[model samples]
Target: MSKLLARIAGYLSNRTLVGVDKLGNRYFTRTEEIDGIMKEKRCVIFKGEGDPTSISVEWICWLNGQRKRAPTAEEQMELEARREPVKQNVAFLKQEEEERRAKEGSSHKAKSTGKTGGPDLKSFIHQFPTEGNKLEEESDAVDRGRGEDEAGAQKAKEPLSE
Candidate 1:
């Protein structure tokens, strides 16, 4: 097919190696003349099974032309190192919060009416009749009124015997 031939031709064309990700995927770019204008083409060569998810955000941005330059190894390393401390801090805070909640949950079991330690508005609201109940009551009253009107109309239609 012409598309397959074009792909083969593109692979054969001279492409500059931009970067290699931690997953061993290689990224490359090439310039080609199309419609009398020079355009840049980018592609990735997977190291193994070609899983798209294996690509990092930075490399994805470069591949999609969202970034002007490919990510450097130093930048990636620095970001990874920075993320480690943040992850540790998050875990520590979560554990601390869980411990506090456990203590409060045991000691204030009766005092706590809800999650916010305030009156449960949901239960309070349930004590009142709902809109559907109100509507049914109103309709019953109207039906009773209609019955009275019918009875009065029959009386008015009766004649007096003198």
Candidate 2:
């Protein structure tokens, strides 16, 4: 009876089932001439009782003529494979950020006890040059600043002018 009804409704004129989705929605196609150009009319019969909005976007694309045919199982698998790596990378970055925050917090706690074991060093420790136990400033033989005693001696050595 359903076959007779479908035939009467013109939906069965040249319709052929092409694919079915995971949710069991059935896709169909019909070839016809429209304005002298051969075209395929694609559509779907959704499974079970529900709103038509539940139809998957891939199926929608086929039905709307955006895609040549229903998406294949292999295509779905490829999409999943491509997405897995990105998901893993995002999770890895999140874990690394959490570890950095935890290390920073622990360093703050260690400072209160004055234990000189961890990464606690003055910020400017590396700002100046050093060789062995001496810094570049201490090793300089020339006192470029000119001490008070040197200024007084130089002034006394100068001849008095009229």
Candidate 3:
């Protein structure tokens, strides 16, 4: 009767079971035996959380102590890196893209229209270097005064009421 009890205990201890979720997470449990004799205790071989798709069934078996392969520290780190959470700000990214597009469109329209002196504004200043020329300074001052005058004129043209 003792021999039969010992054999039953041993068989139970040596048995292994594994459970997996849809997300590839896995859990493994096994019965433990000591000195060829089955014990009434159970042990966890592997209890990991992550996408199971990244880990193979064979790897899981090894992790559970059912197979011979042992996981190394490097492997563990690599798996951890893969499982790390990714941060994304989709709304902010989209807003930035839209602003960039609007800037491009306005710049394109400015180039196409003869407004703002077109492209000659760049080369003209380069060709006529400012070298203490009073006339050039006066022209710039006049341009500024003229801009203010135009704004004032537009305001004065508005209908007046008593």
Candidate 4:
């Protein structure tokens, strides 16, 4: 098929027919995975006679045939053991990141509080003006001066109202 020929050409530069007859041309076979299913199919490459790609395809098929199935239980356990180092490395990196964040957070709080060694929340609150104290001071000052000037002027103008 045209699709098969294109696929084969991608993996090879030159190809040659191992045999041919009146029925159909049977080129040398090469194995490839088709939709996760490994299969061997005849390849047609456009190169001239005595192309080396055919021999390469034969070796590829041989290698495919030599591949075995998945590993057994003991082999799977061995693979899991091999992954422990990677897991430990990831955990160490995470711990280092957490420590770095904690350090940065403490330093930022200390800067906001104007503290040298560490953050002090009580000292930071002392910098702000309290609404209750300010209001009380304003009200007392207004009450003490209320109507004093008017009282003085009225007393000076009255001619002994008694």
lDDT of each: 0.89, 0.78, 0.60, 0.59
Backbone clash pairs for candidate 2 read none
Better of 3 and 4 by lDDT: 3
Each candidate's clash count: 0, 0, 4, 0
Point out where model 4 deviates above 4 Å.
1-68, 109-162
Give the lDDT of residue 56 in candidate 3: 52
Model 3's TM-score against the true structure: 0.19
Ranked candidates (lDDT, high to low)? 1, 2, 3, 4
lDDT of 3 by residue, 1-162 (tens): 999998888677645544443334444445556799864432233345434446654455566557654445466567656655432356667889889879998888533544555455677676675777867888999999999999999989988877
Q: Sort all candidates by TM-score, best to worst.
A: 1, 2, 4, 3
Q: Positional deviation of 26 in candidate 2, in angstroms? A: 0.4
lDDT of 2 by residue, 57-107 (tens): 777888888887579978756776787899999999999988987898888
Q: Which segments of model 3 are wrong by more than 4 Å?
A: 1-59, 63-67, 85-162
TM-score of each: 0.49, 0.39, 0.19, 0.26
For this target, which candidate reaches the highest TM-score against the unseen true structure? 1
Which candidate gets the maximum lDDT versus the true structure? 1
**Which residue pairs come into collision in candidate 1?**
none
What TM-score does candidate 2 reach?
Answer: 0.39
Give the winner by lDDT: 1 or 3: 1
lDDT of 4 by residue, 31-149 (tens): 67889998765543334455444433333343355523323346545766787899999999999998987899888852354455756677788766566687678778887677677
